[model samples]
Target chain A: MSVRFWRVRALAMLLALFVGGCTAPPLLTAVLGPPLKPLPVAGRLRRPVYKPYHEETMTYNLVPPPKADWHAKLKALPLTAAGGTDWVKALNENLIKPKPGLDAKAEDEPVMDLDVVLTPKDAPDFKVTYPHKPHTQILSCDNCHTGIFQMQAGADPITMEKIFAGEYCGRCHGPVAFDPASACPRCHTAMPQ
Target chain B: MRQAALWLALLVLATLLPAAQVSAEQGDIVFTRSSKEEGADYPPATFPHYVHRMQFKCYVCHDAIFKMKAGADKVSMDAIDKGKFCGTCHNATIAFGPTFESCQRCHK
Candidate 1:
């Protein structure tokens, strides 16, 4: 045979092997029609036909079981009534307890409540009252202080658009922390005059 | 000769591209061992495998802390408290400890 003929034959063989190996049975079935049905059994077999275990129907209930109000527990403590000593001071007085291991001086030092008003010029009606005291209970100051919000006031250019896009406060507030959308009144406390 | 070299390079690239794409996209695998086990106190632990994969490689836990096969690892509260399985990471300093307060974080 000529060298050219031998080369063409070898190339054809390679292509055939590649195509055969790459073509899955399911893909071929999809392209063509459904595969031929299995031969019908005349009588019942010794063992029963396999049925996949349905986890939803079959699984045992949890022993103690999860609380129905589990998601509700994530909500922030309700705000104190409007006509009272500063909300922060009232919240601190109710919740803050002395750390057992801390020194006498450290124990005596009151829980720092740095409440700030966030009033964007665009949204004159809505003012965000950021109560730092509650967050301090769960998270260390550095968690948000330097990383998200600057220590100095008005340093970070926080906007509603940025928060919704999962920047700054949105990082934890939306997913891990409180539900930002539902808990609007929790943050936006200032009543429009 | 240059044409043959280009064809060879293209063949190699075609073979590697699919594998690279598969490894890049790792989906979340939720573990529901509580359903199988008898007398589970809480709901099944929803393990966000994708979340951990972001920080560390697959080999960090697979075949070391946990077996490659599913349902192979016999995880228990006692085992975790002794810093055996999940306790290795959930030792307070590394991650939240498997204490009473943090139960809902995973159990739900």
Candidate 2:
């Protein structure tokens, strides 16, 4: 064989090893538990490298955990770890407290206990039960009231198109809270057969 | 003697400068002067500066919507109902309206 052919063969072997190293981890780990110790190559023909699955990547944030046991604290809360963070749940559970103002001692307005049930004319199955408890817990009544929604039921024409466009519920849903685009059951809890 | 006079002028300007500039840290403001008889009888609306500041930036209400000075803006129930001053937001839509039932929410 020519010198060029020998060089190409060596390069192909290196490429094969690189690809095998990247793809062989999960298959190897399943068959055998994580590698216990590094292999010592005294007279080995080829060396094999094993990659360990990083447990840290599964954590919510890459930032270092606080000195306190935050794992226990977060685990206690009703957070949708698989889904996005449900801020409303955190507020409801008192896991996180929002001050009415900059003053740590400032009093917040009383929570208005009201639930508006909206049965969209088009899709009554996806009836939306808009709870005031979560909203009034942090925001003042004036925040929405007659501006975005009227006090009377069936007053405002709410549509999915409008919400996705960043109007009405879309104003805060996508920007601040869990995205409504992905999470439909959050609002449309009244699904009937 | 000239230096003393100049110092007096400077002192007066210092006090008056803030009135014009409108400090954001002027905590709560109570509206008292009302032209209507019913307005005078009702408790003055206590505007919680800290509460609003948390929700909105200073520019949301300052200078354009409301003059920063205490007495600069003549805020009354009528003016508010007409969509001026507090009425701009408190029109039973944006914020809680300055309604008959909601008088205590702010006045308190």
DockQ of every candidate? 0.05, 0.01
TM-score of each model's chain B: 0.64, 0.69
Return the clash pairs for model 1, or none: none
What lDDT tens digits, residue by residue, belong to model 1 across residues A104-178?
343222345889888877885588888876666434554566767898766799876787777777855553445
- Give the top-scoring candidate (lDDT): 2
Q: Candidate 1: where are CA atoms >4 Å away?
A: A1-110, A191-193, B1-108
Q: Tell me the alpha-carbon RMSD of every candidate.
A: 19.1, 28.9
The B-chain TM-score of model 1 reads 0.64
| Candidate 1 chain B least-lDDT 10 residues | B18-27
lDDT for predicted candidate 1 compared with the true structure: 0.52
> What's chain A's TM-score in each predicted model?
0.43, 0.57
Cα DockQ of the candidate 1 complex:
0.05
Ten-residue stretch with the least lDDT total in model 1 chain A: A44-53
Candidate 2's displacement at residue A188, Å, is: 1.1
